[model samples]
Target: MRGEGGTRRIVVIGGGIAGLATAALLARDGHSVDLVEARDAFGGRAGTWEQDGFRFDTGPSWYLMPDVFERFFGLLGTSAAAELDLRQLDPAYRVFFEPDSGPSGGTGSPPAPPSAAHAERDPIDISAQTATNVERFEAVEPGAGRALERYLASARDTYDVALRRFLYTSFTSISPFLHADVVRRAHRLVPLLLGSLERFVARRFREPRLRQILGYPAVFLGSSPDRAPSLYHLMSAMDLTGGVLYPQGGFGHLMDVLVRLARENGVRLHAHTAATEILTETDRGHRGRGRGRRARTTGVRVRDQTPGGGSERVLPADVLVSTADLHHSETTLLPRELQTYPESWWDRRTSGPGGVLVMLGVRGSLPELAHHSLFFTRDWPANFAAIAGGTVPDPASAYVCRPSATDASVAPAGHENLFILVPVPADPGLGHGGTDGGGDPAIESIAEAAIEQVSQWAGVPDLTERIVVRRTVGPADFAEDLGAWRGGILGPAHTLAQSAFFRAGNASKRVAGLYYAGAGTLPGIGLPMCLISAELVQQRLREALR
Candidate 1:
């Protein structure tokens, strides 16, 4: 992994998982690395915040794709299980639907019980096992269960071929797929790749409720089931196959271990330092002589804002890797003369929706709750339409994470730490609603509405009073604080045209010695993908140096 040039100096901007992971890998390869963060702490969106003796994780509650975390730690010659206590969750997550919303109780087909005798026994009663729970969700519609089994079988195949073979490959260009072996496999993938999750689910399940249940994961792609490709349904297979897991203590424990490994590997972390601009030096001779020439990055201008009034400093480096939002890095931070994309690019990028997050620390715990829960709105199609059309859903589907219910370490003796998230339309256009310049009051109003909705639906008595501490994050806040374009938390919308290789590449097409990672870059969003983004960049840097 060492570079051809001895001791290459690497500078990483934005100390999120992508930045930290990239710096760690580069440092482990004996490269001199410096990691900079705008906030006082690391972990970007995944960072933790504490108030009134209650601690809450700001973002990302569920831990899927456990092997990615393991691979990252393995790069540092360590095991994640050694530093973090990983626990697999049973029943994965609980899905709550409105009563009598459909013809059948909406649980989809239940998988076979672990024991053969149990499977033979009269439909094991979920209601008997857990009183408050609804009836056992074996498919009521004729042939629906068998259809689902077939659909899952196909999804498993997609995961084996696409996820392992194509999704993980580092495609510098489309040329690699032109190879015979790659082409043959890709030809089989075309139908699945172009197919929508909505169509796939509808083809399998006769009941609308079952279709909605299986189609839920498509939203993780930042699009609706009708819009997101069926290939993405491989996410469900990932969940049912590996099962969901959560690290004991909290997700922050895993972040802490990675940070420790990075520091131990000699990666310098400078927190509370915001990078204002990426400096570059153009070849003047070639420009004056009317010949095409490439420009080289000189360094970065970073502002230290801890002192109220900040002082700016320039740091030189051989290579620059930015894990910050792609649009932000291009338009706001880089020099105007060096801007690669147009203003309209930001508009298109921001058109994607953002979310309103409510982090609550509760006084008492609910015994009936699981580690993760999703409360689907009555009308799934309308809910997503509101989000995509730049309006809040009347009853938006909300996600809740009660980590303390699974592991007592997340809260004190008799409390629960709940992290709630509801996706909302971002500002219709950039530079409006005070977001382009700073925070927006209108966005705050939307978040307050979400809190009220959660109270009425979840049956939390004295919902506001039980909240020991509360924090709200909106698109405006994300745009200002995290430098996200239009405050998009998941980067560019995971639309069919923008997924995988179609996503912004890790290396800049216009600049030399520049690379990109994080939510905005290829492999897309989620903790696992962000870590892989770092690996891709590290691999490219090594090749470039060689």
Candidate 2:
């Protein structure tokens, strides 16, 4: 660790994964760190809630990238696995597709005869009651599972070379790629970048349902399968190889461990504290020279609303790291003149859509359910088209996480904790301020439709009646609560242009002593990337201080 003489005083805005990770790292390195979060608690969007003795993780049920979590705790000379019970789920998750209808109007397609290829193998039918449909699913696409395995194998290679070697590298400038070491690796990454995920999968499998199931993750990045880069196939590899995991207790347990690590290392966390303004002192003489103009962030004005919404206080700091939504921090927090990017630049930065989440506590356990389940829409292309067109899809594919299936601590003795999410277009009709087009009814209707669809797929009778408690979150609420620009769940879309160096720089182009980490910045979304973004910012800040 370095001495405190040159130690930078840092304040991080937004206590999301990025903010907390940054604070922990900086503090571990002997820097003075204070984390001011707008929310009443830390964890930002991934926070949790407890109601009537049942606990729920409000956002991000899937915990991928175990390495990111390990690296985060490594900075504090500990490991996340030591504190958190992260169990790798077997059979990863189940995918539910609409039961096939026969030639004219039957419930399912024609049943398939047992294939010689897997005569001795045990068939895994997620939709068991729809046995006839499962056989039809196999019949429609012979060797569909085998093709998926092959696709995943190739994707695993891409993950090894692209994500492990390239994505994590902090490219302060593009000049490094011109080096021979990087040049050699470019060949592998280039092909994947140029190709489309849809085409890549189509070349291997002929089944429409299997194609939809395999290609769905790309939509999380807001890119159509036909448009998304083939490199995105690495996402599937992560799930297939690493396996989806959930922390014991809940996702918030991970947050709690992080907070403890930060506090132990001398990082100060101010919950219920909102940073209203950023105070910067810039060298006027160096303005507009396209050169060095050293600036120091003197302090932040925080509004403490804990005690009847009282006055503000100025907390001093030498540097500032913002893990809040990059667009929100740039457009709303900083002075207009200090925002280097124009409206057009921001307008072109197309963030992906927000999510409609349904948190439910069921009265009794559902034995057939898995820890994670995905109910894909029948027409995925149309659903995506609606989102791209800035309208909520009439029928959206949905995902459900039943943590209680694996961990008993989430709910009471015999109850279950269910979290369902459906991605919808950002509200307010795109060009206008983000607002749900049809308001509460529209969002609720989407949830209701999803519940009905999921219930049918799961073969549950009167599923809605079993719900003991329920809470719904819409796009508007996400925007207001998280300061998301368009209520986007995963930050800007990870299109080819928006990814890598194209993402907003970790440090502001206009503001000195200001840095960014989290989904809205570099390395993109998910817990792993967000943590890496914080590390990248820490490296940049360390170099600047030197």
Candidate 3:
């Protein structure tokens, strides 16, 4: 660890993964760091809840890109394996598409006679190896095995190049990309950047089911594959190669680890504390607007969680990093004049859909369910379209996580932990709670419908009765909990226009000492991106300090 770099006082807003990581990094550099969070607990969206001997992780159940996490821990002079128990999921996840609509028959073999059980149940088990997934793909289309091998080969190259040259680049300036290493790869890079993931996959694969499977990872990027840039195809390669692992407890476990790590690094965390305003002062020499000098951030006005509380104190800081909701932090906490992105600019931006989550503690186990299951309908495109169009898709596809299947600690003996997620449009009005569009009933009604749909899919008609504990969170919760922009669960979509060079930056371009991190900033959303965003902010801070 380094000695005090003049003992800078740095205040970090939001106690999410990004905020915690940034605080820890800054503190490790011998800076005085204080992390303030509005929530009663740390972890922000990755929060967890417990009731009746059941523990449920609220957000981000899947753990992808293990290398990102390993690197983060390594930077702290430890290994993630020593701090946490992470196990690779054998069948990474199970995707159940509409029967016959997906690949059910084996390649070069007679279509397997559908038994009554097989007729009712059909799912492609995705494994860690590309060969295993290719075999499953071959079951649907005769020649798909070879095609997948080829596609993955190309995707691997892109992933490697991106990991080396793109993902870590802060994009704070253009000089980084002007290097000979990046210029040499222009032929491979340009095409990936120019096309959409859907088009790219369709050009390589023929079956609709195969194409959907290949492109589905884009959902994590906050856009349908059709809208996401092909550059994100790297996700498929990363997942297939890096493998999906699960922390012993859940994704929440990682947050707990981060909180402890941050504290160990001398970062103080203030829960239930909200930042109201960013205080700034112009440099003395360039004062009075005579010079076109931007103001520098100095501190934040905060209020503790109290009834009708006003600003309780001004926490002075040499630098401020906000990992809170980008839209809320910029438009609400900072003065309009100080904000580079205006309200109108935010209005013009397209955010990813928020989620309606159902957490159930069932009395009995579901032997048929996998640890991670994705239930898709015949017309998945319609579901995507409905969400993109600002409406909840009727019979929307759902993702179900039964963590109890793998880890007995999350639920009581013989009980199952069911976490179901359905994507809803990120309409600002929707977060206010309503029933205005497409059989869009009240939030509770939607929960009932979603529950019913999942119960049917799980083939447990009595699934509702088996639920000993149940809780639901709609868009309204996202708005209240995370102060998310339009209640978007993820951040901005990875559409061509909203991707790198166009996505939000780590530093406030117009304000000195004001920086940003989290899903909304550079490298975009997901836990891995949040970690990367923290490093990006650290890089910016180091550069400025120097």
Candidate 3 lDDT, 58-94, residue by residue in tens: 9998888778888888888888889889888868888
lDDT pick, better of 1 and 3 = 3
Cα lDDT, all candidates: 0.70, 0.75, 0.81
> Which of the two, 1 or 2, has more TM-score?
2
RMSD (CA, Å), candidate 2 to true, equals 5.3
> What is the lDDT, from 0 to 100, of the residue 279 in candidate 2?
83
Candidate 1: where are CA atoms >4 Å away? 1-5, 100-137, 140-142, 175-184, 283-293, 349-352, 428-465
**Per-residue error (Å), model 1, residue 532:** 0.5
**TM-scores, all models, native as reference:** 0.87, 0.88, 0.92
lDDT of 2 by residue, 1-546 (tens): 234678978899999888998999988888989999987889998899888778989887878777777877787798876888888776577777655422311112223343422321212223322233335345657766556656767777767666555566566766646756557768777888888887777777655555665677786665678767888888876665566777898889888888888899899999989989888787564556564434546778889868687679998877888898888887877877677554567888777877788888888877656888877655666777778778777667788889998888889988988888888887733221112223477676777787787777788877889888777788778788888878877788878787777777777766678888998777887788888988888789778877
Residue 447 accuracy (lDDT) in model 3: 71
- Per-residue lDDT tens digits of candidate 1, residues 36-141? 9988888987888776666678777778777778888898898877888877776567665543233233223333233422222221111212211222334335
| Candidate 2, residue 92: lDDT | 71
